[model samples]
Target: MEPQLLHTVTGQVATVVIRHPAKRNAMTAAMWGSLPPLLETLAADPGVRVLVLTGEGGTFCAGADISTLRGSPLEAQRLAVAAEEALAAFPGPTLAAVRGHCVGGGAQLAAACDLRFAEEGARFGVTPAKLGIVYPSSATRRLVSLVGPATAKYLLFSGELIGTERALRTGLVDEVLPAGELNGRVAEFTGILASRSSLTQAAAKEFANGRTDRDAHWEERARESGDTSEGVAAFLERRTPRFS
Candidate 1:
């Protein structure tokens, strides 16, 4: 059978599983190609309020599948870039529920998400140094945004996997649950996000991301938009905003 990128929706949450467990959920090129469309579909679907990215067989992604690189190195490189862009631009909140080794591209995947809830036994790293490679721009920007430029430089320079405790201290993970308790913690977290208003969540995320990069035009646009008024009214009425 073709390698699977398992996907399923439950209520307002959808999970995209990295399924190649025997290889520690290493993703092949074809699987990478399929992910952009899958993410696009999820982003467009009003029903999906949140997304959880996990792995099969107790492990998160190990990185790009090296075996597939032998066929077309250049194509593989381009595809990987596009995949990261797709992930970075995903509209809804995304949570990475990580365990085992989250290394190399695995680190990139988790970094792209809105939040990361890690297992107590989790490990994470960006291993470009070990592979004699350089990290890409989009990935670097995302990492730098989360942990600051100095920390981002240190982690990339070291290419060393860090334990869950250190990962949390560095702000790489939002929470570090006991190894066996990660799944339950992530379920609880996603359930909370799913129950919230999707429109408010999207706008709040956008505002947060753009907080540092202020634009007068954008501010004016938001001011002119009447959604905030309706949101305030809904709050007073204890009702959800009928966002247009």
Candidate 2:
């Protein structure tokens, strides 16, 4: 089958699946380029309260298809960075549901999400060193943020893969589950996220992503959103909050 990105929505969760199983879901140049626009479309949809990124079959993504780099490695790296940035900037909650190998560009994509949940056997690596390519500065900072300077340097400098236990311990992954339980857990978590107040989630995401100037802006949104009132009313009435 041709390598492609597949999109599907169930309830409020939108999923983007990377499909290139013959190469363990390695991204083609076109696949990398397609991601930003696809994310933009999903972000604009009011029905999309959450996004889940994963790979078809088991492997998340091996990296950019190495053959695509023959023309210009720099260009491929640029495309990957753009896609990663877009994912990081997504307005609502985003999660990466990972299994098998999530390395190189795959790790980049997963890192861009707000949360990552992996299966026990999943392996993660940031492998530019192996290819003798400089990893992007933004991606480097993000890695440091997630795993701290020591772990990020260990992965980037050595290009070695880490198992789920170390990954969760170092904060590279938020949760690690057994083989058959990953999908169910991701669904449960995302459903809870989808049911929360969007106003709160949006503001928290921006603040967590380092937008310090948005405090006043989010305060205004909260005042106008009616979610606060709805939440209090629901609490008093002993019912679920109907957050618009």
TM-score of each: 0.86, 0.99
Candidate 1 wrongly placed segments (more than 4 Å):
211-244
Please state the error at residue 227 of candidate 2 in Å: 0.7
Candidate 2 weakest lDDT stretch, 10 residues: 214-223
| Candidate 1 lDDT over residue span 147-218, tens digit each | 889888888999888898888888998999985888888888898887665556666677776654645655
lDDT of each: 0.83, 0.96
Best by TM-score: 2
In terms of lDDT, the poorest run of 10 residues in model 1 is: 212-221
